[model samples]
Target: MPPPPPSVAGGGRCILSFAALRDRCFSHRFLAAGLRPLAVQLPVGGREDPHTTVHMWVPASPPRNPLLLLHGFGASATWQWYPYLRPLIAAGFDPIVPDLLFFGNSCTRLPDRSDIFQARSIKAAMDAIGVTRFGLVGVSYGGFVGYRMAEMYPDAVEKVAMVCAGVCLEEKDLAEGLFPVAGVEEAAALLVPRRPDEVRRLVRLTFVRPPLIMPSCFLWDYIKVMGSDHMLEKTELLYALISGRQLSTLPKLSQKTLIVWGEQDKVFPMELAHRLKRHLEGNSRLVVINNAGHAVNLEKPQEVCKSIIEFFQEPAYEASNEEKV
Candidate 1:
């Protein structure tokens, strides 16, 4: 016979939480993949007095083709990009994955929370590591940061591959019903969830088919660990990225760009992808994956990987190479 379950099943919940923590641990898996943790002190938010610390996982050897992977709003960079490390490395690209300020080990007390600031911080971090130029792959929230980086430092960021980044989205979209939520408050509730049910909503919004059996204890654990950090700042980042934004003012990229979107994405919607592709004016390719949602990277990792690999590997974007996707 078995001993009875702990009161309220606390023991099982603790085990699940511990497992989640272990699984989300970035250092172990990345270190095993030949990457190392690097903490660089740099001036962020364009201020000198309040220096921010940027943490990253990078290869020990200089990369022949370096690529920066920026994660979205959910978990840390490792949680989002771990699946791509081996595949990217095998493709002869050294992947630089960073926890943008307020995520993972990176933090700042300066209070500025804008994608431009995030971009500048990342560029400073790369310079400290002696990497003059590299490619970039940013998903969701990371796509906002990556877009700013590509805009501010075109020479440094040679090529860009954005997955479901709503760079072309105008602020009016929220009030105009282009978004799933009405405004930043509701958006924050989903992106920076504090409760178990909020996590459920996020999962539903992200995936084409969210898991049917998400244990409440696991959601609570994930919230306490992954989704609860730097709440005010993360919310500010969202407002900074979205509020008063207009595509007419958005700068077009000089480097070749690759835009990937899930056909069923409800968060930013498929129109934003088309808007971004058109905003690029030219020299950009859009690939829409079927049966995927906002979290296309996680749902269709192989297709996303193949698109990025081919994007960077290809020398130029021929008109003939463009697809209606």
Candidate 2:
């Protein structure tokens, strides 16, 4: 086999950074789709002493009903939501894709790592950008934040679409064999992988059928670019998610909720999706995409986007009638 492509020289060393090239390509895609990058600084507790900065992709002229796309634990907003933007735009929706705190350029100096904090920060970002009433589509960890946004500000959040988010997961779910991993620590390690093997494990768990022979160098490069940042804080966020909450105690959201799950998701299984639907009582709809796993949006973007557009476009009265039926 031939040697790898020429390494890009940076910081006085040769580095093969596919992620850097991918990020440039993602940015170009966003530009081509008519979305511009915007960064806003949100005050903590309405004070400027310490603030959180959020990075987002916004339209030049906002649409009447804006949609916010929140990314999961893996790559940033661009990599996760770029595929859905054009479809949403064509369907008469303005989509704002924001990198959740610690994912892209978004970060907070505050000690809080819960989804509540993330929700508030995102809300502040939207408010800064003059988006008061908008819909939300969140996948995986982002679904957790989107759920909190809907719960905390029901009127402000119009419609919610969650993809493979285990918001109803309790601390006990680990020992009960709900997840492929044994416990929180193991789960964290896999989710925030620092090694090539761990990245492979994550890929296996995330997709129904991942690449069978991912090169070790490629995995290492991915971890170096994507998985290296905010490692400690991300682990804290995971712990905080389950530490103070239980499925029974989770609040029932009032907004019309759409839960999209991969049929073969091992991370947050189909059982969780059904339970989430029932948990939301009469306010939720569940869509299970066949032959997909945790990263359904990436694996089956067309199906996921179609379900989202249909759900969001359905009239309120018709939705109510369907629910009744």
Candidate 3:
């Protein structure tokens, strides 16, 4: 990637730092896409101490159909949704990307770590921003939150799109060889990498074809910029997801859903995609992208965006023809 944007300082001297430069780069991209950052504070029930602060990207002008983009575990919303902004905007959709709690600038002092709590917080954030009804697009871990959001607030969530999110995964799936990792702990380590080698492993697992040789320096830089935050809390989130909920316990959603999966996904595997589609039954459409992995948005962004745009634009009666690439 290009060099990070120049860091700015309020005083006479320039405050040059890696963190500042990375923040500037993210801000520049968000502003370039006509998105302004807004921070909303959510007061947790029965908590008088520290409340939750959620940072989100909102359109400069009031958009017609709002689209909520929820990022996965690794990076923040900026890194995940920046690539799809142009296409989403061109398609006449307002994209609202938010950082999940303990990721990026979003944090909560609430004791609850379940996806239900996440769903509540996200709903609160949307309500604070005056988004009454919107479409939801979530990738990976964000898919869990999205599904919960759709289930809890069916009136608020219109259409749903889950990108490689194993919403149907049960605790038994881990020990049953559904994933490459042995258990949730190993998966968590790979997902939330602290070291450069772990980041490489994550990339290898996420992409259909990862770079054969990536410099350690570059990987370290990425880990420094994106990989080093709320490590323990992230791990807890994973554990809560696996242990707190199961496939049978999940509530069925009435919204028309789009299930997109990478043909070579190793994290959740393609089987989970089919399972999720089955769970949604007649209300869902499945799209499998060839040669892509868990990070299909980054690998085949155009195809993914096309699938989303088509799904949202096409009438519900025409969704019987499932598309595969």
- Candidate 2 residue-wise lDDT, 107-189, digit = tens: 87889998999999899889888899999988989999999999999989999999999998888888878889777888788
Per-candidate TM-score against the hidden true structure: 0.91, 0.92, 0.91
- Residue 8 of model 3 has an lDDT of 31
Question: Worst 10-residue stretch by lDDT in candidate 3?
Answer: 1-10
1-325: candidate 3 lDDT, tens digit per residue: 1122222333332233454466678779889989999998875565422468898999988867899999998777787777799898889888999999999899887678899899999999898788989999999899999999999999999999999999999988888888888787987887888876787778878887777665555655666677677888999898899874578888888999999999999888888988887787777888999999898988888999999998888776544556788
The sequence of per-residue lDDT tens digits that candidate 1 reaches over residues 214-310 is: 6677777777777677888888888888888887888888888999999999998999988887777767888888888898998888889989998
**Can you give the lDDT of residue 62 in candidate 3?**
80
User: What number of clashing residue pairs does each candidate have, in the order they appear?
Assistant: 0, 0, 0
Estimate the lDDT of model 2: 0.82
Q: What is the C-alpha lDDT of each candidate?
A: 0.81, 0.82, 0.82
Q: Evaluate model 1: give its TM-score.
A: 0.91
lDDT of 1 at 146: 95
lDDT of 1: 0.81
Stretches of candidate 3 above 4 Å error?
1-23, 45-50
| Cα-based lDDT at residue 162, candidate 1 | 91
